[model samples]
Target: MNAISSYLGSDHTRCDDFFIQAETNVSNGAWEQAEVSLAQFTEALERHFTMEEKVMFPEFEQATGSSAGPTAVMRMEHQQLRSIVALMRDALAARDAESYLGHSETLNTMMQQHNMKEESILYLMADRVLSGRQEEIISAMTSIDAPA
Candidate 1:
């Protein structure tokens, strides 16, 4: 894997780990643990999105000179993911395991598809077009603060 793929893909895996932990906690009916795990998962995912939207996507768009391509699709998918997460949060607050699990399943599917597109396509193109600026982009992404 090239630098862009290596960095963002690793972050994706990290977010996946958190997602699994949250889902497992919910499955076990451990509401408190589920809350903590879900919070962690949300923070990690939001940070990943922020990194891509704030740093990587902008650089990729500028380098490629097009804003209506893959990055736009990713942004829209991010919004959908956020909406699902909000639903999951509401379920968690209501202590509705069935609702939470249903939303979690949907989230898992959406995330898998989203990550595949980014890892297989967008990241590959980014690695090619953003060559020689890998470190700079990575550095900028790293400097971004986690969502409040």
Candidate 2:
């Protein structure tokens, strides 16, 4: 009986770990390691987003019959995060540590706020409304392919 909160909350931690590793590598001027860590972070984050957008959000919307609520807001925030990640990627490519760190700071702030909303509100709501189907939804989320 694993709740959506637990499943996705753990994923948040997983992504955060990757992000921290990437940021630390970049800070140390370990370009090669930074590249690898950043790639890992990006992949983990994209997978987390996909699981929510493709699986959990749809299920929650369908069950609740409200597509323009929290899911919409989360989607918008995801786009914002993606844009920041793109900037970080560009900075990384140019070996601009200052720029990359700046973007990383913004991204870290955004991710904290976004994850708070999800864990506090949306996920709790989903757990209540989509109770019995948690396993099914979690399974689907787990099976989704990582983003390119």
Candidate 3:
């Protein structure tokens, strides 16, 4: 895989693992562990989404000469995930396992679908549009996970 694809793919794998851990924790009545897992999941997701939104999306838009294409769609999907995450966090804080689990399941499904499309179709489109500068764009994403 090229640089952009590699970074996105790796992030997706990490997100998937955290989501699975969250599922296990919730299923086994380990609310505390699940809470921590959710925090980690949320942080990682924010970083990943920030990277796409701030750096990669702009680069892709510049390359493609379109502002309201694939990246715009992904941005909307991110907003959907963000709302669900906020609701899930509130539910978890209230010590409501039923609501939390329901929201978590929905979040996992939404995120999985989003990541798949981002990796397979959107990133592929970026790869073609970025010409040979995918590495620089990937490098620009490094700030995403930096300490804030």
Tens digit of per-residue lDDT, candidate 2, span 42-101:
999999999999999999999999999999999999999999999999999999999999
Runs off by more than 4 Å, candidate 1: none
**TM-score winner:** 2
Q: Give the C-alpha miss distance for residue 128 in model 2, angstroms.
A: 0.4
lDDT of 1 by residue, 1-148 (tens): 2398899999999999999999999999999999999999999999999999999999999999999999999999999999999999999999999999999999999999999999999999999999999988988988988899
Candidate 1 global TM-score: 0.98
| lDDT winner, 2 or 3 | 2
In model 3, the runs with Cα more than 4 Å from the true position are: 146-148
lDDT of 2 at 47: 98
- Give all TM-scores, in the order shown: 0.98, 0.99, 0.92
Residues 3-82 of candidate 3 have per-residue lDDT tens digits of: 68777889888877877787678778788998999888888888888988999999998877898988999999999998
**Model 1 Cα RMSD, 1 decimal:** 1.1
Question: What global local distance difference test value does model 3 have?
Answer: 0.85
The alpha-carbon lDDT assigned to residue 63 of candidate 2 equals 98
Model 2: CA > 4 A from native: none
User: Cα lDDT for residue 18, model 3?
Assistant: 77
Q: Rank the candidates by lDDT, best first.
A: 2, 1, 3
